[model samples]
Target: MDIVEFLSERISEDEAVARTLLGDRTVSKSGAWYEQRLLLECEAKRRLIRIVESARQAALAAMVSTPDQDVGWIPQSLQWMEQSLNALALPYYDHPDFDQDWFRT
Candidate 1:
């Protein structure tokens, strides 16, 4: 798949994982919960980075093989990948509250 499609799929998968981690709670309240959540997020980020890196390398390789005019898509794709990496750095959930259950049912 293309970089945009691949990143979109990864984003959806990450959101699903977040939902599973949160369960019935809108926000995690336990430190342990946050820790576990961070681990999952980190793993997701790693996967995203890997995909982006691969796409970037492939784009660079393609730029060498194809005609200059036809290779314009490479820069745009790289920009999109950069933006995605930036978005991934932002926090998705609120701080722990210490009032909810440590483990959701």
Candidate 2:
């Protein structure tokens, strides 16, 4: 599956696991939401870091005596990646919990 779909499926699976293990408690959603939020932030941070590194390299290349024509895309790429980072950093709120017995029931 594509990355987005895969991520969604994995999140769903984790929710299922949590619910199965703990039976829909009041805190289940909180735990799952926190976990997913953290994962998304981490992924976004990693992607932004990569984009920054690439931009730095491209900027350095452009500073040299003979700059590559492709250096023009560096700023635009950074902007786009920054927007993505911001989007991912937004807080997601949802909290639900399940009891272990809920699974057996």
Candidate 3:
């Protein structure tokens, strides 16, 4: 899956976890709780971003080191990382007016 799909899935999973921890009624009942959850989700996204970037850099270095062989996957992987990073940079759940459909464009 592309970065957007990956991050979206991650966010959904995090939300599910939060729901389970706070219960459905309490999950959205308090601003402080919601903010805390959102911060946690953002931290997860940041970690994913770092991991993807590191992998992309490694692929790039490998591609450069072995120029003779077919390294087409390196470019594709870089593109995926770039897209995912872009998606992760968005306001996402950090904003009160966040919209899931905004990423569709």
Candidate 4:
């Protein structure tokens, strides 16, 4: 499943529900507040979904420019690497950069 596509579908659904809930009604003050909140939440999801590709690219860049090694930072970089693989449906340790033994240092 493409995560971004899945999220986009969800956002569409949320927007539809919001419209239906607020469509024909004369909302009270609190109802108006909730309606605004719901629309904002949907907008937030859309903004986040728009950045999914940027995240994937950043993760791939991390794999390409890894440090020689980082005791503290390697774990976080690994998480980013893992996220890239997850999005692409690749194996966890499929990249040459993951092989410490292959490095001359």
List lDDT for all candidates, in order: 0.60, 0.49, 0.67, 0.57
Ranking by lDDT: 3, 1, 4, 2
Question: Which pairs clash inside model 1?
Answer: none
- Stretches of model 1 off by over 4 angstroms after superposition: 1-29, 90-105
Residue 20 in candidate 4, Cα distance off native in Å:
2.4
lDDT per residue as tens, model 4, 1-105:
444454465567668887777875777778767877989988876765556566656666666687554445545765654454344322213443333322212
Task: Predict model 3's lDDT versus the native.
Answer: 0.67
Which lDDT value does model 3 have at 74?
A: 85
**Residues 1-105, model 1: lDDT tens digits:** 333344445556666666666665555478447746755765677787888879988988898877655887898997776667546533421323211221120
TM-score (all chains, Cα) for each model: 0.52, 0.38, 0.56, 0.53
TM-score of 3: 0.56
Clash pairs detected, candidate 3:
none
What is the TM-score ranking, best to worst? 3, 4, 1, 2
Off by over 4 Å in 2: 1-27, 65-105
Give the poorly placed runs of model 3, Cα more than 4 Å off.
1-29, 92-105
**Top model by TM-score, which number?**
3
